[model samples]
Target: MRPPIDSGTVLITGACSRIGRELARQLARRARTLVLVAHQKEPLEELRDELLASNPTLGVAVEKCDLSHPDEVDALLDSLHRHLIQVDVLVNNAEQGEFGLYEQQRWPHIHQMLRANVSAPMLLTHRLLRRMVERGRGGILNIGSGGGRLYIPGMAVYAGTRHFLEGFTESLRLELVGTGVVVTRVEPGPVAVDAHAPPSWMSISAVRCAREALEGFERASPLVYPGLAYRWMMRLVSLMPRPLMRATGMMAAKKLRQGTALLEERGQRVLLAGGPEALSR
Candidate 1:
């Protein structure tokens, strides 16, 4: 049987962003309370209002927290404690990624990403997983990336962090086998977030990604690849040799080093353009 998600108090980080926002919307009808956490308060307030309008009985708590900072994370936890809310499900959905050569990337950006992507989730899990184990029924859903499985010259630190999540989640699932606490990690490839940009056949909408993630979480899947095509692609990538993947990465790196690859910042996403037509656009 799948682990129960209904009537639970769920805490979701990156609550205002694409996947996190979709997760909140989908779970609002089933979850008793949704504790929304993000760096900004305004967006969370707006989303909170929208959710309540849809599900009047649903409880919503908006927390403004910069996950990169340790003190703010502590404050978030303290606030939840003061409110007497025991989280039954924890969704570590917040993330940071950079598309550039590792050495060329800003140290501050790298540091912040490490804290947000690695330390925050680890601390949150450590702080909350004990209670879940005690209760013997709970969930932890980690929103990671496909970068974890491949050799990417750029986004090295981000990929490393995701690899950590992949290992941590798999090992935690093993330890929690008989404890009844469901642990799952969703590695989404390309989730469609923009309406104006040209759509890719490989990209799935945020809603579909969230829906698939929840389905996998309920089934207690150790790892989940969101889109159908992306899922099959990841499976194939796993079957291939590491040297072959490295060779592909080297070819991309060659383009980047030779100035043929252009990294364009589109809204929240970083787009990598390879050819003349791509660069022209």
Candidate 2:
């Protein structure tokens, strides 16, 4: 069920960031051509250069497209068509998330997140999948989140989008079962980027996550939970009843609200003690 990797043309969105960059780096050695899509032009160019320096024969095309806009996504597709690059694999890795109470979140940001996390992927898939089906060989790798499985009070929209992806990818995989167009969803918990370390049990490095994700996609696995400890923990969580899961989420939400209240109190104390200047710092 493995889709063609070696000598394939792979298109990866958010190619300048952590997991996306790492996926590009790892895939460069095996993929014949790579279409690296990102919003930042400088970083995308830099990544393309780095990939070329290591593998001179590899074909790297840097595309600057903001996934928050449907027009930009369309333009990206048009550019690929003009360049005559037929993508053999697609990695939907770009996403946006805002952490706060849904009511407190700004509408613009929420809309951006909706477009980036949900609309863009769906549009890209709708546009590219038919060609893949006609070609009879391709792969789609969807980057999802653990939040899709659990309820979180602060990240309502973000979690909802992930849940959409979880269902979309699984259903798409079933539909494409014998088409040789593999579909896989990699659900990762919190990931560590740069020098910021994450809890050993709940997170993993972006590089490791990307590597495992690619491995899972190659095997055409319907779902992949990255990180050793996180995978086992999710397995345990999956066995819980819906009621217990909701209770656990409620407890976590309560703790978060308490923590926020404490922080607000501390800030208010500082403001009252030394005026607004003290709280500014």
Candidate 3:
């Protein structure tokens, strides 16, 4: 079933980030009310103001909540209930990824990734899906990564979390078959996040990614692989045998280790020390 985007009150988590912000911008012209949820209060407020500036008739509510914490998730839900705001659409886009060798990665970063990438989305879906089922109309969009299906070297934990997301979304879509709720998981390849770095031939702009995501959601596609070249590449990757993939991953891991050693020799931080942009690809 098509989601009621034309007039629905959409709740978008991680609304201040790239894909989330783009989704909000496109939905602003259609969705009745946008509840922007994110960790930073200033960014969410800024996004709300900018969205309203472009869409004067639109209603926007900025909520500050860190999805890495379960108690904060409950607080967010309570705030929604207290305000009597019924979320007709839920977009689970909040994510945290740390790129490093599995043994060298910090426990805190891994825990945060587990909570934000897996636990938070599951909690939000569980809380809001019941009302959607009862109302007989709603949509759930999960923004995941191609790494979920592919073997990535430095992002072991991040990739594992994404794999769980893909599995959970697929299973949930099956269960919601007759419930009149739409579920879509968008698996995007390398997305252009930094302007200073030269664009990769395989990477797509964030705008294109968001546009393709919505197209897939509206079509009720169970899974969406955005970007033409990337889509074809994933298709080819899917055809690869597990042993070959493992061998390929081994090569990549060796390169990553070499890069880390070379950079450390020059007294420089690791490649992904910058942030998720490295592993986000």
Candidate 4:
């Protein structure tokens, strides 16, 4: 059974951009109170204002903390608890990805990505899961990627982190079988959030993906594909042999390199900097 929609507050991490921002807006329509969390203050403030503009009486709060830092993540949660705030919906939307080979990636960036993508979520969920279990009514939505299910070269660490989340979510669902708390893992393929793919791919818009995620949450679905393409892709990938999948990934990588080289030759800035695209390889 699904939980009541308008009964409580929701806390969304990485609530400042793209899918996270849209999810916040949609949830705000049903949730009585919202806590928007992000690493940057400016975007969070902007989102808070935007929400307030839409719902004048909406109780929107902004929290700024670097989740990559364990201390900061804990401190942020502590501050919320101090204010007597209870998170009925915990959207672990924050993620950091890599764009290069594992060995080529700097130690600091890899460490930070691991911390934010894996450690922070694990720690935060550990703290909140117990409470949600006790309450017997809560929603946990984790934003994952298709990289986890496929063998992508440049994203070794990134895919590893997402795969861990996927495994964790499944194990957690089993553990909470009889509990009312719902756990959802959203694996979106080529979201239009500055992905590193060539310009030909039609990636799902972030808003569309966010809407699907919220809809899935309402239905208490354990896993959701943000778009039809991704759903079909998952099935296809699952049917492919392991070695075949690796070979396909290699072919895709070679094509991407070819395109990148062509663009660079034409004096086009081959790198798409900033936003989620920077995370893409």
> lDDT of candidate 3 vs native?
0.88
RMSD versus native structure for model 4: 4.0
Clashing pairs counted in every model? 0, 0, 0, 1
- In angstroms, give how far residue 239 of model 1 lies from its true place: 0.4
Task: Give all TM-scores, in the order shown.
Answer: 0.90, 0.90, 0.93, 0.88
- For each candidate in turn, give its C-alpha RMSD to the true structure in angstroms: 4.6, 5.6, 2.3, 4.0
Candidate with more favorable, higher TM-score: 3 or 4: 3
Which window of 10 residues has the lowest lDDT sum in candidate 3?
A: 271-280
> By the lDDT metric, which is better: model 2 or model 4?
2
Better of 1 and 4 by lDDT: 1
lDDT of 3 by residue, 159-229 (tens): 89989989999999999998989999999887788522354778877788889999999999998998888
User: Of the candidates numbered 2 and 4, which has the greater TM-score value?
Assistant: 2
Determine which window of 10 residues in candidate 4 has minimal summed lDDT: 193-202
Specify the highest-lDDT model's number. Answer: 3
Q: What digit string (tens of lDDT, one per residue) describes model 1 on residues 62-128?
A: 9999999989999999999999989999999998776666766678988998999999999999898
Tens digits of per-residue lDDT for model 2 on 1-281?
A: 78777999999998988888999999999999999998899999999999999999999999999999999999999999999999999999988776655665678888988999999999999999999999889999998888788887767787899899998998999999888899999988767755235546666878788889999888888899998889998898888899998898899788767766787788732111211112222
Tens-digit lDDT track of model 4 for 149-236: 8777667777788889899998987888888888888887777754232333447777778888878878888888877767787878
**Candidate 4, which segments miss by more than 4 Å at Cα?**
194-201, 252-276, 279-281
lDDT of 1 at 85: 89
